[model samples]
Target: MGTLEGRLKGKVALITGAARGQGAAAARRFAAEGAKVMIADVNDAEGKALAGELGDPAAYAHLDVAEEDDWAQAVDRTVAEFGTLNVLVNNAGVLHFSPLGQTTLADYERVIRINQVGAFLGMRSVVEPMSTAGGGSIVNVSSVEGLAGMPFLVAYTASKFAIRGMTKVAALELGERGIRVNSLHPGMIDTQMVSDAAGGAEVDFSRVARRLALQRVGRPEEIADVALFLASDESSYCTGGEFVADGGATATHALKL
Candidate 1:
């Protein structure tokens, strides 16, 4: 649907959390690259709307990434609707900010359920179909927090770190099957999740950006571009790698010179 030439021609991609944010951005980019995309999310209204906007090459499938049955059904629906599963973008996640002591066990588990377990299920659910389709790519959206630690985001950091580890393990195991698994680490992206983590307060992004090499907050579309490369043959030799889209936030430590 875009003016750009096809980079993902004839491929079928399933993107979780595709109702909005980075997930939606990836869906649009993938479709533009000539890939049939399944927008899977619990937000039925937005998901359906996006699918409609993408027209014939896109469809919506209701999915709760935390639910195994939901993941199973979503994958089945994707393969049925698109005829094969070639790419997966596990972009659904929740952010919770709380100090280690203040973070409840329930809160930690909830974050893990969606961010960590959700990706595990997604990768597991698609292996057979993707293998059958002659191998595919799986991009797990982790965070800059995954590579390092940050105060007050105890649970979120843990889940993201888990995703990073899982991606490497999956890549090692699925490499021979032609499945490439990679983790994406983003920093200070302007999204609803960041807003929610700030308790709906206006974020002074400029202040956060000043500390990074790029000196700006990242856009969802920027991350989507990286996802596009991972999903396409452009990254054919890449697997079990960490793609950091942060504004160089992780390049330095606390002792700011």
Candidate 2:
């Protein structure tokens, strides 16, 4: 059980793509802060393992974010287990790299379905439950690409930008219901997402590090910290905003070498 003193004590959260990486990080942090978490993912083994590791108040739900039925089931299970839904983290995403000319419709739609449509479904699914709970927070994990363009990542860029746009729209529409929606734009972080897009080729972060104002790749834990603030009461006044943790990637213009 989450202690009474924890920031998220009594709150329940559903985190997508939580079997590993950033989703896993947020799950741990939220649990430590006293929130009950539903670790939703397609990877059953890892998701089950994580739920076991988190113990009481943390459970795993198999969710295919692209499927609307999966969304309904996950939300129902969350409410059934924890009693109410208060926080949602739409963190499941895939990265694909190809020139716009080389990108196939299938490839582009795949990214949009997971990153964009999934988020839309999540927001819609939670509205009624969140209203019942008096209010809630939604964190949509976008990328720096959402802020500006990047080469060979048209599909991913489009999905993230759509997430950014949808966040604001949800915020405006859901405010009366006491639900807040916000987007998180992260810079080059040390995560497996990019390498997976590169067919498992290891990324050399040194070159990218030199261009960042922080001179280092961001960590999953760091982004989790920002997410923590958004999930808790700390960001109550914030809604429909772009909360960026991109290591100053957007500070420089395209003209910069």
Per-model tally of clashing residue pairs: 0, 0
Which has the greatest lDDT? 1
**Cα miss at 19, model 1 (Å)?**
0.5
Write out the backbone clash pairs for model 2: none
Expressed as tens digits, the lDDT of each residue in 1-257 for candidate 1 is: 34458999999999999999999999999998999999999999999999999999999999999999999999999998989999999999999988888889999999999999999999999999999999999999999999999999898899999999999999999999999999999999999878878899987898888899998999999999999999999899999999999989998999976
Q: Ten residues in a row with the worst lDDT in model 1? A: 1-10
Alpha-carbon TM-score of each model against the true structure:
0.97, 0.97
Estimate, for each residue in 103-202, the C-alpha lDDT of model 2 and write its tens digit.
9999999999999999999999999999999999999999899989999999999999999999999999999999999999999988888789889999
Q: Give the C-alpha lDDT of model 1.
A: 0.94
- Runs of candidate 1 with Cα error greater than 4 angstroms are 1-4
